[model samples]
Each structure stands twice: as structure tokens, then as C-alpha cells.
Target: MPGFSPLELEALALSLRVALWSVLFSLPVGLFIAWLLARHEFFGKGALNAVVHLPLVLPPVVVGYLLLVLLGREGPLGQALYRLFGVSLPFTWQGAALAAAVMAFPLMVRAMRLSLENVDRRLEAAARTLGARPFDVFVTVTLPLTAPGILVGALLGFARSLGEFGATITFAANIPGETRTLPLALFSMTQTPGGETQALRLAALSVLLSLAALAVSEYTARRLRARIDG
Candidate 1:
């Protein structure tokens, strides 16, 4: 507890909050994209897939800069949003969440797509043959079968968001109690004289949180697999 001072605690809490928001905001979209990539072949599908995975290949700073250019107050989308809705995304906690979500989206989509691909098509077909509507079949059969993948994707996205530094800092800046997440806090501590101890503590906390997320994901996936196999 001593290692987690008030500031450190605040950073940790903000990291969790941002990461949770990132996952929540991206999950539905990620799932739909994954389903499209896995099940449907359409024009420009390859291009769409590449765009979804672009962040994985691009540098984090590049992604952050692009977000800033497109979502900044004076940027086109930003200006339209401000003019219509008075909503601003840059340099705020919500902006940080958006950055995190963008960075983590590829991982979530990949996991869900793999899961979707692995699902037996016959099960879905059988449901359809039994007079279930397409939406009902997907909701009852496809979604349940892909739940493990979705869970794994969510955990991966959460971990990625927690560790997101470059994009969040660039797009939202390291504003204390707003966008200063755990990684940003650790980075700040590293730059300050006599802050090595705090930096190490934050580093350890980050590792613990990431490990816990992975463990939970694995456990949930295994339980789901067992249930499915049984």
C-alpha cells in the first residue's frame, strides 16, 4: 500500500477506467467486424481487414498522430462534432480511451475472427433449418460458440489499453487525474529525480494487472472449451 501513493493509485484507477471504457466501446464493433471478415466475402474486404489491422503494423506514435489530426478540435470531424454536438475528444480522458481502443482493436478483432472461423457452420445451419431467423441463429448459436474468443479478445484489449502509452499520451496528453494512465505515470516517474522507487512500484503493478487479466482470460477460455467439449 505504501508503494501505491495517492498519485500512483490515481493513475492505476484511471488506467483501469480507460481500459474498461476502451473495451466496452470497441467490443461490439470489433465483433461485427470480425464476423464480417470471417463469414462474408465482399468487395474491398481485404482493404477493410488491412485497415482494421493497420494499427498493429504502424508505430504507436503514428496512430496517435493520425488520431490527433482527425479528431483534434480544429480537425474536420472534430469541428463537425463540436459544431453539432459540442463534444470534444482530444486531450481528455475520453480521448485517451479512444486512443486505447484504436490501438487495441486489432487484437480484439483477430481473436474474435479466429473464434468465428472455428465455429461449426453446421450448427448455425441447423438452427436456421429449424425455422430460426438469421439474427436469432447468430444470437443463439454463433455468439455462444464464439464467446471464448470474445472473452479472450476483451482481455487482450484491456491489457493493451492498460499498457498504451504513446497513443494515449500523444492524443490526450499526460494530464493528471484525466489521461495520465499507469504507463504514463511510470514514464513520468522515470524522468523525475529520486522517483526510481515509485517507478519500480508502478512497473510491478502493471505487470501484476496484465498477468491477472491473462490468467482470467485463460481460465474463462478453458472453462468454455470444457463446457463445449462436454
Candidate 2:
């Protein structure tokens, strides 16, 4: 904290804020999509799967650009929301969180999907055989089994969101104390003549934070495996 300047602190705070919101917003939707991919068969299911995983295949900049096209002030949804609620996202922190969420979604969905795939179908069947509704079966049996994976997915999403740059910058222009998250701040440092020192500091922080997230994820995954095994 002592070595971190005000700008670095601001960027770190913004990154955490954006990552948290992105993960929180993405969690339920990601779980539903993951469940669909892991369990159900339906028309266009393959297409839906592809679309859900598209962000992983596409360039972050392209994703960000598409978001800008669809959510910018002049865009249809953007215009409607602006007129109806007086809310705007472009070039704002919310926009940054949106960009982060979009970029991180594929990772979250994949993790949860894998978890759901590993769920014991027999357990769900037992729940249903006992006259439990499909919804109740899922809530009581599937979700509890999948909770660990959901947590890992959320952590993965948070880490991805924290590092998100191209999409965020493309959709929400970097402004210090606002859209300038850690990655953006580091990138900005590179462009500035005397900001190398600051860049190094931010880079170190980024590495540490990423490592911490990964450590927690790995530990949690181990616990999940142990529980299943026991």
C-alpha cells in the first residue's frame, strides 16, 4: 500500500469493483446456461452452446466493439434504456463492468458446465422419484452439488474481469478514477514517458492478485474433490 500511488490505488479499487459486479451479475445466468449445456437436449442447442462460448473464441477487442455497437447511445437497446430510465452505460464504470462480464462469461459458464456434467444424475432422479418437482430437485440436489464449482467459476470470472482490458477500454474509454482499471492504468503507464515505475508497480500488483485468485480456486477445487471422494 505504501508503494502504491493514488492513481494505482484508484485503479485497483475500480478493478475490484468492476470485477465484483461482473461476477455477481454473471453468476445466476451463467449457472442457468451451464445447466442447459450440461443437461438438456433441445432444438438449436448446439447453436446456443456456441454462442455462450463465443467470447472465448473471439478477440476481446471485437467483443468490446460489438458491445459498443449494440449498447452505445445511438444503439437500439441503449437508446431505449436512455429514454426510459435516463441511464447510460457507455464510457462509464457500469460499461466497464459489462465489458468485463461479457469477456469473463465464457470462463464462468465452462467451469459451471463441467461441474454440472459431473453431478450425479441418480441423485436428481431420486429426488424426482420421491415426488419432488423438477425445480425442487434442482434446488435441493443439483445446486448443492454444484455450489463448489459455482464458487470456482465465480472466482475465475472475478480474476478474468480484474484483468479485462481490451474490451473494457474499447467500450468504456479509460478515465482515471473511473474507467481506468488496473490493466488500463498499466497500459496507460506504458504510453506515458515517465510512467515505467508506476507500470512496474501495477504489474507486480496484478501478478499478486491473479496468483491469489488462482490459489484460492485451486484450494477450493481440492476441497470439492475431497468431499466427493469422502
lDDT per residue (tens digit) for residues 19-126 in model 2: 999999999999999988898999999999889889988999999999888888999889998999998898999999999999999999999999899988998999
Q: lDDT: which candidate is best?
A: 1
Mark the regions of model 2 whose C-alpha exceeds 4 Å error after superposition: none
What is the alpha-carbon lDDT of model 1 when measured against the actual structure? 0.94
lDDT of 1 by residue, 102-204 (tens): 9999999999999999999999999999999999999999998999999999999999999999898889999999999999999999999999988989999
Roughly what TM-score does model 1 have, to 2 decimal places?
0.97
Native-vs-model 2 lDDT?
A: 0.91
Task: Report each candidate's C-alpha RMSD, comma-separated, in the order given.
Answer: 1.0, 1.5
Ten contiguous residues with the weakest lDDT in model 1: 1-10
- Backbone clashes for every candidate come to 0, 0
Q: What lDDT score goes with residue 125 in model 1?
A: 90
Cα-based lDDT for every prediction: 0.94, 0.91
Error of 1 at 164 (Å): 0.4
